[model samples]
Target chain A: MKRNDFDFSQPNKQSYAAIVFLAYHFFRILVRQLWPVLIAVLVGRENLKNMLFWIIAGISVLVFVFAVISYLRYYFYIDNDELVVVKGIFKRSRTNIPFQRIQTINIEQSILHQLLQVAKLEVDTAGSKGTEFSFSALSMAKAEALRQVVLEQKSKILPLPQTSGVEKISGSELALQTILHLSFSELIRIGATQNHLRSLLIILAFFMTLYNQVEDIGVDTDQVVDQINEEVVYFGKIAIIILGLMSVLASFTFSLIRTIIRYYDFTLFRTNDGFKIVSGLFTKKQISAKDHKIQYISWADNPLKRLLGLYDVYLKQASSSEVRDTKSISIPGCNSKNVERIKFYYVSPEEWKDLKNFKISGKYIYVRVLYFGILPAIILGSLMLFTDFKIYSLLTALWPLLVYLAFRVNHKKWNFAINHELIYIRNGIFGNYFKALRLYKIQSMALRQSIYQRKHQLATITIYTASGNINIPYVHLDLAKDICNFVLFKIESDKRKWM
Target chain B: MEFLNEQIDVKGLPDITDIQAEKLAANYLKVIFITRGLTSFIFITGIVVAAILLKDISVTIRFSVAGLLIILFIWFFSLSSKVFNTRSYAIRQRDIIYTRGLLFKSTTIVPFNRIQHAEIVSGPIDRFYNLSSLKIFTAGGSQSDLSLPGLLSSDAARIKSFIISKTAQDEEE
Candidate 1:
């Protein structure tokens, strides 16, 4: 299905619309580099104006020229089952990616691209570092056609077993079977329930940066602080309450806007090979992963999400060491039934039924409290006794109660299980999290014993996978050994591909 | 799959601690001492120079610096020997285990199937002593999971080739 409109026989440059894309990137870098000076200028730093203005203008001109040259120089073509990319203006660099090595071809469309009816294509390889190659701007039709060709070539190279029986359908038909979509109300709920502490930190960081910049421009921050303190004293408790409410409102609004922009029109579709997720508003993104490539499935729900009956499910795949986070796709707003359906798709019901649950030793609670509670309390208490901060010692007294609560949570949450095919772990600090992975997917296993653990005949077993590490701590040494051996046996004997 | 229902005998399973580990080369201790001596010499020289330049500096400060240096020297010497004695590595049919550390000992086991690559590297001092270090990398992280230093160059090369072959065999299966 080669398009006659765009010649595939020779190396092809991205559409001229790519110049706009390049210019935007160049402008972003320029703005980031010159932001301090720009802020200084805005703050009425008169002496530096002429110099800064000339410097910024010169850089902008250079960036524009470079963007044009880069757009002109970049070209790509497929030759003998390899995608060859020739780029760079002054120093030419060529990258050849074989079809078998291409892990995912992601098509993204920024607001500018949408306006121009073009798409950006990012090709990711199994390499651990970053995106292998990205074509900044291509016609929407051409980008989709190239994606199809690359995928077809990749299938020919690897020959996926599960794709054999499903009947091939056109692209339009394939996009129709959406597995999940987030409603506006669901998005609002997610936004409202976001971690407020994280957003507060971000807001604090922004103000801190601005304060630093103002100080650099010779503004007397001490005077400003004095004025603010006097105002606070004058306004008293009402001022404090108003400020708190305003900050909360600001954080909530920020979260809401972020959620709307990120999850707008989010959709997941099932294809013959695997699943495809399309999301984002300003910059649309499409990510697809095959069924067999999924290494594990996990879901987590905090107290707020639990109240809203929402669960965020993550499907992890074998990823490179550097970009492990990018390989997993998280689907928010999944109900219990949806979670079970996805679990069933990855693991058979028979295998799931065979799982034998095991709880960690009760001593784990004592150990955690000793390490995370009493140790800190001792240091703080000793500091208070030695120093003038005697009043602060009262905080140390509260550690025992905190430690008891932590112990209770630890004892309740730490559970693991193993079936014939998969291992399941349930853990979390303040929320419930569940992870399940096939035994064969584990790359390595280690049975470790600390001095205390050794004395108590307890061991910690760590299973390493490409995506992350799973630790089952404070289990009987004999049980840990048996589990380690069984995992190793399964890994060695299983003939199926782990990825 | 049939083994899923069967009771696994924990005693019958292979234990990493049971493996007879081979100690690093004797010359490795000499390399460690030389490096430590170089560092100590530089540190002592710096203190002496500072004392000489600041003549008005208190005698108490000089004496305390000397005392601290002595204590550090004793601690380093004692711990170095203990660490050297404790370091050992064992290569099994399916995995390699390296155990080290004197006070808080740790043993890292990396299976053949998990190893991304293996390399033999020799620093200037290692080259002088005809020794090399074998580094085994995995997809787990940026750093090599296991690095066994102070092996004769030939031994390192032989181990590297063996690991490479095992990795190839694992990949084929």
Candidate 2:
């Protein structure tokens, strides 16, 4: 079908794929809520277990029927430039969203949705509560048309700057450029750099569930462990070394497989409207961000990635909530040049080198040392006298480590710089995280001081933007005041839309 | 939209420290004391009832709980006044500045152009004292949002309208 083939003027139901998805959704929730009862009935006598199977089958059929009914009742349409969704079996409550209020439109296609030739559509609105509405299934072409229409209607209503000689770029001015793309080799490098501990945790959790299932089927896992222990005793430390090597190998493999699959051929495109990211192998997720919607840009690097001069860039798009909006988009495996280009897209194109760097006061380490080092060490030292802690030796060794970490984090890792147009923050221990934002985009500024800091004439300045907050802590009180005043002046002097 | 970035000396800019801020109403203190007094009374009553109902518990624990509650009440009552006295807000020519907290002092500034909306809020207790609060929201989240409490209803209404007047002018264009 053509892009505009669907009848948007008339109310339409979601694609037929919704029936299966809605049923699966409801079934999962039902099983999650009633798993204890199901487990109890299964552990009972054979006759009751047999009856429980049939009862579950009946419930599945009932749930499927209810999903179909719910799908039939739901209706969505656009009228008077407002998107309206009416859905309820008995209550029949209706929601009306003005075009101007709609923030972002997201489309996602999982493997199942791909098989069904449909996609999930999400609409996030801007407000205090940030109400979100999602449709389980819609034809790809129709979803695109819907998003385009909503964006067009929204752009028309929202006022744009018409004061300067610069003509506003419309859809007609579309010029798509490949801002950044990851090749197979780069993807491999990125996959290799993926947090292996997280992958290992996932593998362990999977095995744990499998082991629980085997135990439920009456397997003697304790006997298996005892056998392993016997083998370990025979091999001595060699067995432990081998086991450690095997776990590391398995974790690396798992991380590589997951990262490759998730970001097989990720491409970031710079469109006239904004930036569009298309990636994923089995599940295709597309994120588009308009220039106006982006609040700030941040890039971070780990020690491993830092070795390869690699950074993962994130566009912190304006969103009331991250869970529902999917507004923030992260692109991994970007080189320094790629990061610079992306940063220039959101922030000013001036050189950030000449800006004077302001480090957080050395007094900042006092609280960190007091709370983390002295307090914990004192507590553990006092407790060591009355209690035997051979089993808690690991806990005993933690205080010194905490103290060192506090010193490393606050002493050398903090730097804040600001020019007339934008602000930059660089912080982190071992690896660095950098954030840059336009000054006019700032919403509010606050300077805070604790009793200790108040006595020391130090304050923390927090700048709130549409996306999130950025804090520069333990600066001189006069510097904080000057920063707040200057930032407020920037925001007040400019007449531009933050998002 | 206009290119208005011009270099200026930072020293010449208007300072926020010079502006005078208005203190909270006296009735606000009474409101806090009454609410805290009621809570303290309930706790004391519960302790007395539990002490009588469970005679196995020693007098030390019973009296300790009561004493702790009383001490906490006194501490909070004193802190409330200190916090109230410390709290003040100033409506500047281009922004609003509010300073709060007793121990951890904080000052917030919100430019008029950045404000999303202004709300007047009053609960049952606030109305009993003929007082209300004005909440100012920006594109920023709750952390940066401003709420000025312990104001006469008429005063709150006036400030809200003043903010709305400044913010609405930008919207109209």
Candidate 3:
């Protein structure tokens, strides 16, 4: 069918007007700051001659407000196999989305949506870079019903089962599964090692942005810098001590918030169609995977988690999002107890036996430490400290030394389960995680060796799944080859679509 | 479709074959000549105009910038030529192999079944030379996708159609 042939209508917003308003205001606030940015760039100072900057800023703000009004006025609909998006102030574009190619439809409601009783719909298709259709605000009930109807229509042509084959497992079993996987102490550790350095960098960047904004308004940045400098001298010793304490507190706070938001009373349940994952404390997120679409399962334990015996579990599916892959659930704090529960819950009991049989040896850990841990640390550290221009000179020496030792300890804790039915691997520090996947689901497998690895007779096996690749690093070359060959054999033998 | 053995048929996989570099080299040079002619013209004009207008700027900085441009031009030329000459793809009975690298050699193979689509693209220069580029898309990410430049237009078309037919037949089964 042609792109425009299908009839499209905007989904009715059952009663989410307030939520829409909230989202609108959020966007408006962001747009309001654009002028301050542009003026800062053009004038190179806060104040400009003839009040031109303010005039320009005022005009721009009016234009932005008009744009927001136009956007808020927009609505859309889908009917008779076509998606219709009605948007624009003067001229409207009623974009049509065909039902034939749609792969999946999901309804997501943020906290605002939940409070307002509205949800957003995301429609995805195979091979498409972005969603084919999206509705910002719709009634929750209508969204689900519409999603089902569209999904059913799409499934008729796409060849997947129309009905989700969710198996209903006992709530007690689910609670057991949750208990088996969740570890309170391990959660704290995972939060601690969450690579907050990136977040810290982002915070620093935000502070710089605020500083720039202040400067743009014609404030003397030199004055602010001087003020900071004066403060440092006025209370130099106290400032240093306070900074140290503040840094520690900030790190812990970051960890605590992340844990509370991500894993807060997370639970996994078995439904006829697939496994249902319910997580998040403030605004719960429920995700389900078709039994057939799951590509991999992984869990890992970070250094702290390892010390506390914690494990984080993740299910990698064919469809992925930023948070889906990143935010994993604590299967039950750092331990082997929940491993069996996870295997049996997702995989068959027979598969569970096979999973248990597969082992991770000490040799693998030693090789991982020698190559992945020590060697890279030394090289990176030396390179950073002894570089030609001496950038990151001090950080290079101190950071790597600490990182190397930490990684070494973490690598020694690495473990994997390679059975006839599934391949599971667990690694990571503070952010402990475990991933498991059916052998048949692996789309591709590769055995790679760097020149250095080759010299040491070490190889890294990367098993490709739909979500991403999972690597078992620094295994003996012989073991790597064997696993690679076995994976290839399994992948080829299975008639299931790994794609 | 069923298991031939309880293992991957490693014996069936093809070994890497050396591809002819002349076609690639010729295309690379033509592209380089066109790009250099346009960019150098722009750069020279910019330098002359800027030198005349910006009297406060030192002559040394301008000359140094010009030198930097020359170095960049040489680097781009060398890099492109090396990449063009080294990159070549081969097709086996069941899979297509692409070999490329200036420093670290990489050979990637995609089986016929895995190919999502194949396209034949001919630019103005390529049309002039009766050559086209063939891109083989797979379900995998961009890195695993294969591109073969500087093929005879007819050959590229023939291969494209062949792959399409093969894929259609497999899917129908």
Q: How many clashes in each candidate?
A: 0, 0, 47
Highest TM-score: give the candidate number.
Answer: 1
By lDDT, rank the candidates, best first: 2, 1, 3
| Model number with the top lDDT | 2
Model 2's chain A TM-score stands at: 0.85
Following a full C-alpha superposition, what root-mean-square deviation does model 2 have from the true structure?
A: 4.3
lDDT of each: 0.79, 0.81, 0.60
Give DockQ: model 2. 0.54
Give one digit per residue, the lDDT tens place, for model 2 in B119-139. 989978889999998999887
Model 2's CAPRI class is medium
- Those runs of model 3 whose alpha carbons end farther than 4 Å from true positions after fitting are A1-30, A33-83, A99-104, A110-115, A124-126, A130-133, A161-199, A262-265, A319-339, A349-434, A437-465, A470-493, B1-88, B122-128
Evaluating just chain A, the predictions reach TM-scores of 0.91, 0.85, 0.70
Chain B, candidate 1: TM-score: 0.87
Model 3, A309-394: lDDT tens digits are 65556665664332233223334343566655665656767555545323333445455455565677667767766667466554
What is the full ranking by DockQ, best candidate first?
2, 1, 3
Scored by lDDT, model 3 comes in at 0.60
